[model samples]
Target: MHLLEVRGLGIRNPETGTEWILKDVGFEVGEGEFVTIMGPSGSGKTTLLHLCAGLESPSEGSVFLAGKDLAAMKDRDRTLLRRKWIGFVFQFFHLLPDLTVRENLELPLRLQGEDPAVHEGRIEEILDALELGDLRDRQPHGLSGGEMQRASIARALAGRPPLVLADEPTGNLASRAGEETMRLFREVHRRFGTSILLVTHNPRDAAFGDRVLFLFDGRLDPAHALEGPDLDAASVFARLEELGI
Candidate 1:
């Protein structure tokens, strides 16, 4: 079974058009798989991510995480499921400015009712693995763009959840930092076998994934999907050019 399945997803609302325009999107991410959804800005990528995370209700179709329909679950149950099963990395590096890096990593565990005493050591392991050990006490405002992103990654991996959804994780970084971030993501998946579904418009970034799916104007054309054991940036860009994405 797929770890994450999005079938025929669409947005709905009589007044707002964000829901009115997107329709019939579908895809799946297998366990231990790394997949990239490549689309230009305003392609409904964020909306799709939100739906998959159960942060929004779909107007049509459904989103399934590990065989459970997110929209079918009660609000509290869905919240608990998300807290325990999904890790999120966003473009903005949503770390709390007031909290230290270590504290930010611990927040998700605490929210899930995990005892800090037990998870603290695990968080340390994550910090060390992600090379954030010395910077763990620094607040978000004190860190560089790269450092903040590293800490965000550390926090996302704190619980070692099975599935991670990253939206333009390297979007705000410089070329060198962005490369480092992508390599870090690849290493994390290699070492931990975490299923990752990342969305980005950059071909270089999208090429890091085992498979690449193209999204244009909020729609996925399965015919344009690229699959390979070693897909490269050149090929990804070629596909994008052909599709005019």
Candidate 2:
């Protein structure tokens, strides 16, 4: 089943009257599918993600999560829906610096009013899955970039939300670290069957997804689906060039 669907979406920056960051964007992600949104900087990839996650309202069009129309909901209802169903990973780690990894991972469950007894076991499961068991007691400041990123992901997954939205998740890591993080993402998708919508400019990272869509001037180029062997660095670079990015 399609977990997320967007149609006729458009976003405008109020300050820049001429700039429509996303224009008539549309896409769908099925359960357990890892789809990548790729484009150059300022191409509205992040805006598309924000709209999908209901962080920002679209100027035009509709966004549906699990068949519920986000634009039709009140703010409070939208907030509740996002909390219960969506998981977001930003480019920045966004972990509370003072919180230990264990505490951070538990925050979502606590907010959801899940029982503490269950949280303990769930935390352990996530820590072992992410190979982060040893770092659970460490604060964000004490962890490496990759470790912190993984912790952020762990926090996002703490509630076991079905849909995961990651915006430029690998942007700040070194090449090796980024690759490892991408591998971890694939592993998570494979094991948990979570639908992921990843926004990224890195071609190598985008290539990891089951399908890729190129965004330019706030619209998706249906003609540019990147899949299979066509996802090479050369093809991605050429598409970027064609988009004038």
Q: Highest lDDT: which candidate?
A: 1
Per-residue CA lDDT of model 2 for 1-109, tens digit only, reads: 4789998998888788667878888889988889998887888888788898888998899999988999999999998899988998989989998889988888888
**Candidate 2 Cα outliers beyond 4 Å, as residue runs:** 229-235, 241-244
Q: For residue 202, what is the lDDT in candidate 2?
A: 94
lDDT of 1 by residue, 81-191 (tens): 887779999999999999999999988888877876797677877887678999988899999888899999888887778999999999999989998998888988987
TM-score of each: 0.95, 0.94
Q: Estimate the TM-score for candidate 1.
A: 0.95
* Per-candidate local distance difference test: 0.88, 0.87
Residue 68, model 1, lDDT:
96
Output the lDDT of residue 171, model 2. Answer: 98
Residue 91 local lDDT, model 1? 96
After superposition of all CA atoms, the RMSD between model 1 and the true structure is 1.5
